[model samples]
Target: MRRCPGGRSWRRAAWRLRCFRFVKIDCYSIETNIQIFAVCASVARRCGYPNRPDRGGGPMNFSARGLSAMFSVLRQRNFAIYTSGSTVSLIGTWMQRVTVGWLCWELTGSGAWLGLLAFADMFPSVIVGPLAGAAADRWDRLRIARISQMLGLLQATFLFVALVAGFLTIELLFAVVLFHGVVEAFNQPSRLALIHSLVGRERLGAAVAINSIAFNLARFVGPAIAGVLIATVGVAWAFALNAMTFGAFALALAAVSLVRDDALAPRSGFLREIVDGFAYSVRHPGIGPILMLMIAAGVGGRAVVELLPGFAADVFGAGPIGLAALTSSVAVGAILGGFVVGVRQSYTGLTRTVIVSVFGIALAVAAFTVTDTLYLGAAALAVAGFFMVTTGVGSQTLVQLAVDGSMRGRVLSLHGLIFRGGPALGALLMGVSSEFAGLRLPVAVGAAILAICAFFALTRVNAIADALENEPRN
Candidate 1:
């Protein structure tokens, strides 16, 4: 009995030793696997996929897949709401735009005043965008957006009332548009900066593309609807519908449940922030070039939008429907361009894409200037649309990708300034040229300028591409 007990004790001890070794080996394997994963994940995250989750315990639970999934969710909800609201609102906005242009033409019959109104409406964006961006960084963007929407609704209502009462003159129209533009100066930056909060940085490019899709989709629908509405209902109903449409967006804004970060720096003096923001933008290599490109494009390329009214009336002689078709063609191309960028995983080749697209835009603009046929004009506009969206979306993606979290709002404000201000300057110059020279002169001149800018961009493509390459990965 003693021998049996001793043998059993020895067997138990040996079994326990083997089990201990096995457990240690298993634990080591798991640890090794996790370390390997972290290294692989870190690499991917640095390559613009910042959402990868680490092993064990960590606060930042990021994964490329997870980021993509989150974007899918946000896209479904935000895109649906924004797209629907914008579709309705943009139709009304476009109608008002066409009517305003027509009214201006009827009242003064000069492209200069038309350009003046356009400049008046858009110029505030340049002046007010930085302040607004500071506010967006400091305040609750959602609330700011809501308030701006309400203000816009009120502005639209006043315009509608004026039109209905027969008190709508060109001056009143210009004043109302200017008021609306001021509101937009605040609204656009907040709305754009707010997008990062909704979807996070990982999917920002996709979010931007989706947003462009919404705007362009509206572009597609708005002009066609505006054309029909103006032909059928007269211009007063168009203004009223614009008011109602803004009201719907306000309601939608009220309904969305956004998750915002509270990490933003406290609000400071407006001028200080604006100056600081501008200084930072000038210093940053990546953002500086992008802003410069936007300025060039806006001034030289995007002014085409301002001339569409004249093109439809003077060049095509097809009236409102023709104008609508021209606008929609551009939108259609833009929508396609947005889709192309939205699907790409990185902005690696964006510099080349932008340069090519800019050249394309120049070619299209030159082509459109010579063409008198509506179909040919539409075709040119469509090509122009494609190039425009590619340039815009590509620049946005590059800027967003290059910026850090702290400076996003400020940098984007500069972006807003270029986007809004560039066109204003362009329109003013073009309008003046058209008045002094002819419509063809502005178009031809703008195209040549765009071509030169594109060439400049191409020459620096290597530097831009290097900057993108050198960006710190997540």
Candidate 2:
């Protein structure tokens, strides 16, 4: 088999090249398509030879060398810098998130206030997501992201100062959080859509996978660090630390230059662009089902992570430590799943992966729902997290692969809504369900729903794969 010209892993970039053929691939071929694209292709380039092998007919290379090749996306100069900075910043962001919730409880001591604060932060996704996505298409994504991070820094600074000076009230907290959410509505789409420019589309899947690993690693470490800071110095330090992290990310963003392709998708009316984006996604067979499965993950029992405190104290009798352990377990599993996704070579396997992992999440959640032992429940949660990452990250890769450059921002913004917003919706349902039936019943019911949805979504994905394989090239 011929190797791609660049030293990059042809396997990693291969999907962006050859997978549209929808030809079958094996573990060996899947294993060795090491270069995501021998070199990242310019997104604006018209259809030509895949910059690398999207599919390779190479003989098996099953040595331990293949393991190292999994993270080949890091070889890109800009992506490595971005990953380093994001990992640091995300840790702080996670820490602040934990601190904010604790601060809210400390100030108000009411679950309802906690719920309201969460609502303030997440509700913007529904209202402003599409508008932000439209702006992503019209303006420079790097500028939007950098500006958003700067605002986030300001929000953190204001909160830190206000808390230290005793200037914060519960109402002030809500307002501060609401401001952060609004910034995020603009930032999230730009950030998600910008990855294509960083490493190029060939390595997009690996880039997304490695990103999840960084995020989950931060997720595991950040809150634990925040917990210590809260116990040792005070919660205000967490906010201050978070503000500093925002500066780090802004600098990182400044260091990386994003390639702009204005001609790729000519600008249209903002509202019309939003309308066109929605129409494009809905008409695509793959995007619809992939998003639905993601929604299911959001609404499914995997989201029980939000309700872990109840399980930790009420059911397991292990209290806060058990809660920490449960969440940490999930993060650990997710990090591993990120490795699986980052290295994977074939989109052919993704349809099956999405379906199987969703079912795996259902079973894992069901087991957790019924388990009384603290350790046992934590184990179940880990399994659920592993499958959840597999499903979410796999769906994300598929979604990115499915859309054109014009629709990338809007489509991914919708995905961001489902990925982030779905859990908020699920949390509300679970809270209400707990009031009516009990903890176990709502989760049990959700797990069953997820399984049913996975099977249904599978039918749509098969059609999607077929359509993509058959799409005529320009």
Per-model TM against the reference: 0.82, 0.81
Best by TM-score: 1
Scored by Cα lDDT, where does model 2 land?
0.70
Q: Which pairs clash in model 1?
A: 46-473, 46-474, 51-62, 51-63, 52-62, 52-63, 53-62
How far does residue 152 in candidate 2 sit from its true spot (Å)?
Answer: 1.2
Per-model C-alpha RMSD: 23.4, 14.8
> What is the lDDT of every predicted structure here?
0.71, 0.70
The digit string of per-residue lDDT tens for model 2 on 1-474 reads 112335568764673354332222212222221211111112101111112223211122223564566567787778888888889889988887767766775675544455456556665776788888888777888899889889999999999899888789999998998888778877888888888778776777778988899988887777667755664467788899999999999999899886534234576678898888888877887787677777887888555776665565567764334445566667766766676566665555565566667877888899889889765675677667767887788778777776787778888888887776776677667756676576678878889999898878666655866654334211
Q: Mind giving the per-residue lDDT tens digits that candidate 1 earns over 1-474?
A: 001123578886875675465445334433443343343334223423222222101122234663464348355575457546656666666666766776677678787887888887788988888888788777788888889878878987887788777787888888888998888888877777777776666777778887787777777676655654555456666667778888888887777666654267555687787787788878877668767877888888788787788888888886666667777777766776666556565556666676767777888788888989876777777767767887787777777667666566777888887887888888888888898887778877888988998888778877876675458432
Off by over 4 Å in 1: 1-83, 266-268, 472-474
Please give the range of 10 consecutive residues that has the lowest summed lDDT in model 1.
52-61
